[model samples]
Target: MKKTALITGANKGIGFEIGRQLGRKGWRVLLGIRNTLNGRDAEEKLQSLGIDAVFVKVDVADPDSIINAAEILAADGTRIDVLINNAAILEDRGTTINTPRGLLEKTLMTNTSGPFNVILAFLPLLGNGSRIINISSGLGVTADMKDYAAAYSISKAALNAVTKQFAAALAGREISVNAVCPGWVKTSMGGAGATRSVEKGAETPVWLATEADSSLTGKFFRDKKEIPF
Candidate 1:
């Protein structure tokens, strides 16, 4: 049986690249997107490259959407070998002080609560040896730096905490749950001046998805190197 992976926000950006890489490796990749049209476009693109890709609607910010996504996947009746929680929004690209409260709440809802919503919704589809990869960022590190992007940074930090808690809870089941910090990459969100390419950014998450030993869980990784929590 081919291994299966479901990646959220995979219509484009790092999620798309990660899907392509994993699909090339022969995993049945499920590309989750909030918009069905965009998801179909991504599905078509991957299909043209001979990758086994499918699209499912998943808006991580909405609990109903997350539940529906899992229900759609449940029809397959197959276990998910990997789940990449890659959907996030950076509402305030700059100037944290000037950002509104509503923006911060929405950002937290999407960035922090979104992935956790997906995981909890799809927990039944995972089993022993399954991998859960949370796409986080280096900016989330409160101990290191905090100049701007307060909402995104704080939400990601909370995400890392969620990752740790899940890892501990699922350890006995042989499921590995960890967070991957993809460096600044050139995407719509990352912008043109970004130094890293999408391929480079997707490397760590893809690596964690396929290569890391099952024993390593609840850790932070950037390009395969474990980083301090």
Candidate 2:
């Protein structure tokens, strides 16, 4: 049977590239976007290439939206083999010390809590041997800490902790949960000076979703190699 993959924020950027690559590999790609129009366009783009793809509307920042999305998919009896939490934001342009009020809260809502909500809401749809890939960032790595995108970085750090928590919680069921930093890819969020392409940025997440050892869980990865969290 063809496997199914669900990718949030998959209408564009690295998320879209990951879905496209997985679709090319014969996986049923579910484009999880908050916007119906863009999601349908992405679905059509993939279908034009003879890839089995569908659009699932979801807004990770809102728990209600996520819960409703889960209900719809469950009603369809969908079993997700891979779940990629790729939706996030980077609106904080100030340093941690001088960060404005509400920026961190806003970032955490979408970046940290978003994945947590997505995983919990979709938990029933995921079975044994399923994979959960959180598209985190090098900015989140405490070992190589930086002050750029203060709120965004802090949110990713929390997300890494969340990954480990779920990995341990689901270990008995053979479900693998891990975090991946896609690097500074040239996406709308990554800006124009980013050195990596979307294809390169999507590589490790795709690997974790499809090729990585099922036993590898609760780790951070970049370029398909393990890295310090």
Candidate 3:
């Protein structure tokens, strides 16, 4: 049977590249996009390239959307072998003490809670040997914590905690949960000045999805190597 991968926010950026790479390898790719037009466009583009790609509407911030998307897949009896939580936002431009009133909470809604809900909503689709990859960041590393993009960083740290919690909680069933820091890729969020290309950023994530050791769970990675969280 062909493997299936579901990537959140896969219409563009690293998420899209991950879907492209996986699709090229003959896996069925599901683009979890919130925008209908963009999702259809992405699917058409990938299809033109001979990739097995489909778009499923999912707004991570809304539980109803997530549940609805999950229900769609369930109705089709689809099994998600790889689930990538790649949707995130960076909305800070100042120090933490000077941060806006609802910045942290807003960021948490998308970066932290979104992934948590995604994991829960799709847990039934994942079975033994399934992989769950969370797109985290270096700013989330407690040892290297700084004030840069405080809300985004803090949310990812919380996400790392989520990864570890799920890793331990689901280990007995042979499921693996891990986080990846796709270092400063040149995307809309990373900006043009960023060092890494989209392919470089997607390398470790694709690896974790397709080639990593099944026992390697509850870890943070970058460039295919484990890093401190």
Candidate 4:
């Protein structure tokens, strides 16, 4: 059977590129998007490239949406080999002191809690050898923490904690849970002035999804190299 991968926020940016790369490798790609129109457009684009792609309506911030997505996949009897938690929001670039409480809450709702909810809802479909990749950031690294983008940084840090927690919880089950920092890529979230291209940024996550060693779990990585969390 062909491996299947589900990527959240795959309508555009790094998430879209990850799905494209995986599809090119003959993996069944589930492109999860909040907007139905964007999801259909992405699916068509991937199909035009001869990729087997499906659109899944998912709004990561909402638990009901996540549950519904899981239900849809369950109804189809689709088992996911890889789950990429790539849907994240950068609400503000303010420092911890300057960031608003509401902004922090909103950022965590989508970036941190959203992934957790998705993981729980889809856990039944993920069996042995399943890979869970959380698209985290260097800004979340505790050793490298600065004052910039405090809300986003905090949310990702919490996500890293989630990665480690799940990795430990699922170790005996042959599941791998790891967090990846895609670097300063030029995406909608990273903006145009950013340094790295979308392909370059998507490289590590795709590798982790399809090719990384199974022993490499519960770790944080960038460019396939382990980084300090």
For candidate 3, write residues 1-229 as lDDT tens digits.
9999999999999999999999999999999999999999999999999999999999998889999999999999999999999998888968888878999999999999999999999999998999999999999998898767799889999999999999999999999999999999999999999999999999999999999999999999999999988
lDDT of 2 by residue, 158-220 (tens): 999999999999999999999999989999999999999999999999999988999999999
lDDT of 1 by residue, 1-229 (tens): 8999999999999999999999999999999899989999999999999999999898999999999889878887857999999999987767778787788899989998999899999999998899999999998876876668888888999999989999999999998999989998999888999999999999999889888888999999997999987
Q: In model 3, what is the error at residue 84, expressed in angstroms?
A: 0.3
Error of 4 at 191 (Å): 1.2
In model 4, what is the error at residue 38, expressed in angstroms? 0.7
Runs with alpha carbons beyond 4 Å of true place in candidate 3: none
TM-score of each: 0.98, 0.98, 0.99, 0.98
Better of 2 and 4 by TM-score: 4
- Models sorted by lDDT, best on top: 3, 4, 2, 1
Model 4 agreement with the true structure over 157-210: per-residue lDDT tens digits: 999999999999989989999999999999989999999999999999999998
Off by over 4 Å in 1: none
Please report, in order, the local distance difference test score of every candidate based on alpha carbons. 0.92, 0.94, 0.95, 0.95
Cα RMSD (Å) per model?
0.9, 0.9, 0.7, 0.8
Q: lDDT for model 4, please.
A: 0.95
